[model samples]
Target: TYAETKFIEAEAEFLVANSGSFQATGANAAAYEAYLEGIRANMDKLGVSQADRDAYLSDPNVAVGTANLTMELIMKEKYKALFLNPETFNDLRRYNFDDTIFRGLELPEDHNSVLNGQWIQRAVYPSSEFSRNEDQVRQAEKAIDQPMWFYN
Candidate 1:
């Protein structure tokens, strides 16, 4: 979706600035624009009324300018916009489930004990895969709580 693309653009621009390849001012400006566009695109997709969209976007909390923009805010918006998406799970893993980036996120009270109070890193392979290709599946097997290489 266009909204997802805009969110990705916002993240890329913000990360580029942090990586020192671009000036913070210019990169943040681009990121901020992309962030707002992402929200607008998602709202449009959902058929939100124009007046409601305008009111939400113009709210003080949502309209925080470039200088106040942070990776947390970008990710939070992306999380909200992509609710229940597989990409959200992938993103949570990418960020190692850091609460700072995903405000209000909390571990389930009865989460798997294998996690030892940490977030689950990834889903286990389906049982059918292990049954069909035991050798390959065993080779790739990891603890349920172990972090994947994709983590930052």
Candidate 2:
């Protein structure tokens, strides 16, 4: 979707700026503009009224200037815009689910005890795989709560 692409662009620009990379100066301005453009694109796609969109965008929290913009804000809006999308999980893992970057996200109260309070990092391989290739499956088995190698 156009909105999703803008959100990803916003994050990429933010990362370049925050990391003090070669394009830091331009990236900062680009990040903020892209962030707002993402919101606008999503709202427009949803058919939100212009007045309502203006009101939402004008709010202090949503209108945070470039100097005040943070990855948390960008990710929060992106998460809201893509709540049902699995891509959000990829972003969460990239940040190691840092509470600071994903403010207000909480583990479920009834989460599985096997995790011992840690986030569930990956789904267990299917039982069908174990049944068909027990030896091979065992060799590659990992705890369901173990973070993927890329995430680590």
Clashing pairs in 1: none
Question: How many clashes in each structure?
Answer: 0, 0
Query: Candidate 1 — which residues are off by over 4 angstroms?
Result: 20-27, 150-152
lDDT of 2 by residue, 1-152 (tens): 88899999998888888773322323478999999989988999999999999899899988988888888888888987888999999888777788887887789999999999888888788999988999998998889777775532
Maximum-TM-score candidate: 1
TM-score of 2: 0.83
| Model 2 weakest 10-residue run by lDDT | 18-27
Pairs clashing in candidate 2? Answer: none
Over 4 Å off, model 2: 20-27, 128-140, 149-152
User: What do the candidate models score in CA lDDT, each in turn?
Assistant: 0.83, 0.83
RMSD of 1: 2.9
Q: How close is candidate 1 to the true structure, as a TM-score?
A: 0.89
